[model samples]
Target: MEFDASHSSSSLGARVVLIPLEGKVIRYAFKLEFQNTNNTAEYEALLLGLVEVKKLHIKMLKVKGDAELIVKQVRGLFAIKNERLRHYRNHVWDKIEAFNSFSIEAVLREFNSKADSLVVYAALLVPHPDFTTNTYRVELVYRLSIPDNFESWQVLENDK
Candidate 1:
């Protein structure tokens, strides 16, 4: 798995790419409405990646990121000084404990390009008016109440 984050003046973007040993790839992107530093954004991406792994019932994982500080801290080689960083570290630990085995490594940004591109894509996403329809129409937006429950949302054509 690889993760990355990008920040703009108005928003923060985070993304993670998971590649299993079987060679399948999964990607996630998120846009944060709040302001955050680059390091904080990296932490958010890491946390989001871990959550996705847990949801997939992955027992072991090797995580790679370009953030040296986060990689070292997660590996217990560096100390977290900032209070906010400490909190993020604690959350990372909590999620890691659920895994049977977990390892993290810092890699050059060049090798982490997929995750980097995802972050850039997320950063560029902007909400705009839906011009496809000339008539204004009310559409029901449905969301699953339970997070990470993809199976619950599957619909058969007949049911729809």
Candidate 2:
């Protein structure tokens, strides 16, 4: 899964792209209807992707995001001092347990361009009626080589 978040004057949006082993690609872009911070929006995108992946009974998952702090927190490296973020982290952990294997890494924005583009579009566009149908459906919606137990900050090993 590749996730990204964007905020406009009045809305927060998230986008996720899921590519399964079967080679089918699914994409999701949704506007957050509630008040949220960028961190929360990032988590929302991840949570949404996890939910859909669980529904599909995917056994393994690789999560990629441009949010460094959130990725580190989920990896148990950073201390989550905020209660809200702690809660989000707990939720992420809960979802992660359903998978046989999981790995998450922080990625540069340019590498996550598709989801990033969807986030900007979601934040700014007035969607057509068909968009809602496209947004929530199960039919909708990369690899970073950072080691699972790495101790320090690691740069992305591959860009494409």
Candidate 3:
């Protein structure tokens, strides 16, 4: 699943999508953007997917993403220092706690290419060229490498 949140001509919008390798492309929600940071947008994507999973009564998820920061944050390694991100992190943690079982993992961008493509396509709908954007969480899946789980800060190996 993925999401791209931003504004188009002074409107608050968000898009929430989830893609399962085994099933259909689930579009949970979509909007232009709201008052949100990229970190918040990323958390929304994960939370939206979790919402669907809850509705479906499914448990035990191996959620994959390309964002090292988000993956690390979710894994309890990186601290959410920003006041803005703290809220999102807390929101995501709440959704995670609702689940029976789940694990967030970093994956190669190649594995998340389709969702990244969705972000680019979503960008085209906005009317304003200079609108504040928050596509980070979804598109960033293409930048992560194999992770090192050796230590507490080892959510990723060679993260740039």
User: Evaluated with TM-score, which candidate comes out highest?
Assistant: 2
Highest-lDDT candidate: 2
Candidate 2: which stretches are off by over 4 Å? 127-160
Ordered from best to worst TM-score, the candidate numbers read 2, 1, 3
Residue-by-residue lDDT tens digits, candidate 3, 1-160: 4433433444333344555668655543334333445555566556656666778776666777667687788888998887555555655776778667778887776776545445444444432332234322222222111112234333332362
- Window of ten residues with lowest summed lDDT in model 3: 139-148
Tens digit of per-residue lDDT, candidate 2, span 90-156? 7789789888999999999999986887776666555523355544331122111112333232233
**Model 1 spans > 4 angstroms off:** 126-160
Point out the higher-scoring one by lDDT: 1 or 2: 2
What order do candidates take by lDDT, descending? 2, 1, 3
Residue range 1-160, candidate 1, lDDT tens digits: 9999888886577888888889557777777556578887898889878877888999999999999999998888999898667667766887899989899999999999988876765665642232122311112112211222334433431266
- Give stretches of model 3 more than 4 Å off: 1-29, 126-160
| C-alpha RMSD values across all candidates | 11.9, 11.1, 12.1
